[model samples]
Target: MKKDIQIPEVSNVYVSVVNEYNDIYKTHDWNAYIINDKDVALEMVLIVTRGFSEIKSTSTMRHKLDMLPAKSYAKIEFMQEDVLALNNEFKVTFFEANKMFEKTYLFRKNTINKKALQTIPLMEVRGVLVK
Candidate 1:
C-alpha cells in the first residue's frame, strides 16, 4: 500500500540545503540549515519518508537537532557517498513555545544552490601596515 505524505507549503523557518565539495577529503558534503525568524525558541527534527511506511532515518539518512534559540538558527551537516540519498524526502517537527508542535515537510527533487559562506566579499588593504 502506498502512503500519503504531504509536503508543507509554507513554514516560519527558512531551510536551505547546500551541496559542497571538499577538495581535501575528496568527498561530497551536504548541509541543511534551519533559520528561525520569530522571537521564540524552536525544536526541530528532519523526517525522511521515502521508500518506507513512515518517516525514518537510515545509515544513508539522518536527522539531528533539538532547540533553536529565539531569532536564531541551527545547522546540520552530513557526508554521503551516494548523491541519490540527498534527494530523500524530509520534514521537520518543531515545538513552538506556548503552542502546539508542528511539522513541515521539505520537497526537493534535485540539488539546491551552493552555499555562499561569504555573502559579502571582504576587501584586503594591500601593503598597509597600521603602526
Candidate 2:
C-alpha cells in the first residue's frame, strides 16, 4: 500500500532571498520571497520557515496566503544579518487543480551573500535563488 501513494513533483515555484535597500533606515537588508511561476493560481498557500545551525536553532515561522496568483511573487519575511550564518529552510505547500504539492527550499549555511546575486524570475532585483 505504501508504494501505491504518489507524491506530486513541485515545479516553477521558487524561494529567493534578495538584498534590498531600506531608504528610510539607510540600510541594506535581506528579504525572502515566494515566486509562483505556474500558469494557474495556487490555493491555500502555506509556508513554514526557520534557520538552524549545529549549536542553535531559530524559532519556526508560519505564513499563509489564501491564494497566490499565477506568475507573481510574495514577500515571506525579512532576514536579519545574524540569520545569514545559519541554514535557512522554507517549506511551501499549496493546491493546484485540486492536487496538493509541496516543496522544500534550503539555503545552506553562509550560502546567501552578495557574491551569489543573480537576476531572478518574476522579480526585478538580483538575488540568491534556491531550487
Candidate 3:
C-alpha cells in the first residue's frame, strides 16, 4: 500500500530552498501576499510548476563553521514582501533552482553600474526561473 500525502494549496506563494551556503534550490512562484496587521509573517499560496528539480539540503553548522559537502534541495517559502525587500536591498535576487547560495552575494551599492542594480557572481548558477 502507498500513502497519499496531500500537498498544501499554494497557488499564491513562492517557495525556494536554501542550502547552508544560502543558495536557492527548487523554487515555486505564486500570487501571494502579506496581509496588514497579521501576526503571521506572511500568507503564501503555493503555485505549481513543471520540470522543476527537487533537491534536498546536506549541510550542517557546527560552532562557527558550516560543513557543506555539495549542493542539494529543500523546501522554502518566500513572501512577496521578501522578494521586494531582496530587490530593494540587494538589488539582485537569485532565481535558480538547486544551486549553492554561498557562491552568490548581494551588493547593495558596490558595482560598476552604481546607478542600476548589479550582481556579483561568486559562482555559476545552474539556471534561473521566473514565474
TM-score of each: 0.51, 0.96, 0.17
* Stretches of candidate 3 exceeding 4 Å from the true structure: 1-71, 85-102, 107-131
Superposed Cα deviation of residue 56, candidate 2 (Å):
1.0
Off by over 4 Å in 1: 1-10, 20-28, 44-64, 79-81, 84-86, 113-131
- Residue 104 alpha-carbon offset, candidate 2, angstroms: 0.6
Local accuracy of candidate 3 as per-residue lDDT tens digits, 1-131: 23654223222122222112223644433221111121222212122222111232212211111221123222222323233322211111121232212111121211212133222122222212221
Worst 10-residue lDDT window for candidate 3 reads 87-96
lDDT of each: 0.46, 0.95, 0.22
Could you give me the TM-score of model 1 versus the true structure? 0.51
* Model 1 lDDT-worst window of ten: 122-131
**TM-score winner between candidates 1 and 2:** 2
Best by lDDT: 2
lDDT of 1 at 98: 38
lDDT of 1 by residue, 10-90 (tens): 345655444556688896565555566667777654443332223434443556566777666555544243433344444
Better of 1 and 3 by lDDT: 1
Q: Model 2, residue 125: displacement in angstroms?
A: 1.0
Go through the candidates in order and give the clash count of each. 0, 0, 15
Q: What is the lDDT of residue 50 in candidate 2?
A: 96
Candidate 2 Cα deviation (angstroms), residue 29? 1.0
